[model samples]
Target chain A: MLEARVYVIMKPGVLDPQGKAVKSALDSLGFEGLKDVRVGKYFAIKLDDISKEKAMERLKGMCEKLLANPVIEDYKIEILDIKS
Target chain B: MLEARVYVIMKPGVLDPQGKAVKSALDSLGFEGLKDVRVGKYFAIKLDDISKEKAMERLKGMCEKLLANPVIEDYKIEILDIKS
Candidate 1:
């Protein structure tokens, strides 16, 4: 089995209201050091008996197809530990 | 500078509507062998000259204060590498 870790973030220049809301909330709560809070999505998946390349391909397809909004978001994937 | 990696996941037993929607979409797209799609959040932060413990305390505060919805999510933090 292999584990895939996926991260999806808003594309540069895209407005992230959620992130902004959080940043404002933080500022109000006295956390003055935080700036540019960009909210993102994360996913962890376990695949059975698949080669890393094929699994990554399928995972990327999943991201592009449904996991992310390509018009406003960009994504990156990292493969964590793999176990047989 | 130190790097912080925060992972916030929906509490177990909480219904993840987004995850379910993604799962169904994947099924429709003919990607079989996938189940239990849990969605989460990831953050990568660069902290300046802060002790690891202090940084963690403040980061945890941020998670509890703004980054996570305490009612439905739980978070874990990983201090990646620290460089002086």
Candidate 2:
């Protein structure tokens, strides 16, 4: 089995209201000097018995197909761990 | 400067409706063999000239203060990079 972790974030120029909301909350809670709190998405996937290379290829296809919005978001994937 | 990345996810027993929505969408898009899609939150914070230790202290405080709901969510933080 392999573990894949994916992170998806808004494009640099895009507005992130969710992040803004969290930042404001942090400010209210006395967290000073924190700025640009962009919020993103994280996904963990456990794949069945597949070679690492094949898994990566299929996972990237998954990201492009549904995990992220290519127009307004960018994503990164990390292979966290693999165990047989 | 330091780059801090924090990820927050629902507790194991907690319901993740957002994740379910995404999984259903993936199914509709013909993604087979995908199950248990749990969604989480990611945060990136760029900090000013502060020692790494101090930055970590402050960032953890930020996470507990407002970045995550301790009641239903668990968070992990990564110090991505630090530069002077």
Best by TM-score: 2
State the weakest 10-residue window (summed lDDT) of model 2 chain B.
Answer: B27-36
Enumerate the candidates' DockQ scores in order: 0.51, 0.66
Give the best candidate by lDDT.
Answer: 2
Every candidate's CA RMSD: 2.6, 1.8
Which stretches of candidate 1 lie above 4 Å from their native place? B1-3, B44-49, B79-84
lDDT of 2 at B12: 92
The sequence of per-residue lDDT tens digits that candidate 2 reaches over residues A1-84 is 667888999999899998888888877887777756889999977666667788788778888998999889999988766545
Report clash pairs, candidate 1. none
DockQ of 2: 0.66
Query: What TM-score would candidate 2 get against the native?
Result: 0.88
Interface RMSD of each: 2.0, 1.6
On residues B1-84, what C-alpha lDDT tens digit does candidate 1 reach at each position?
Answer: 677778898998999888788777788998877755778997766556677889889999989877888899999989877545
- Per-residue accuracy of model 1 over A1-84 as CA lDDT, tens digit each: 677878898988998888777667877998746545677889866666577788889998989888888889999988776556
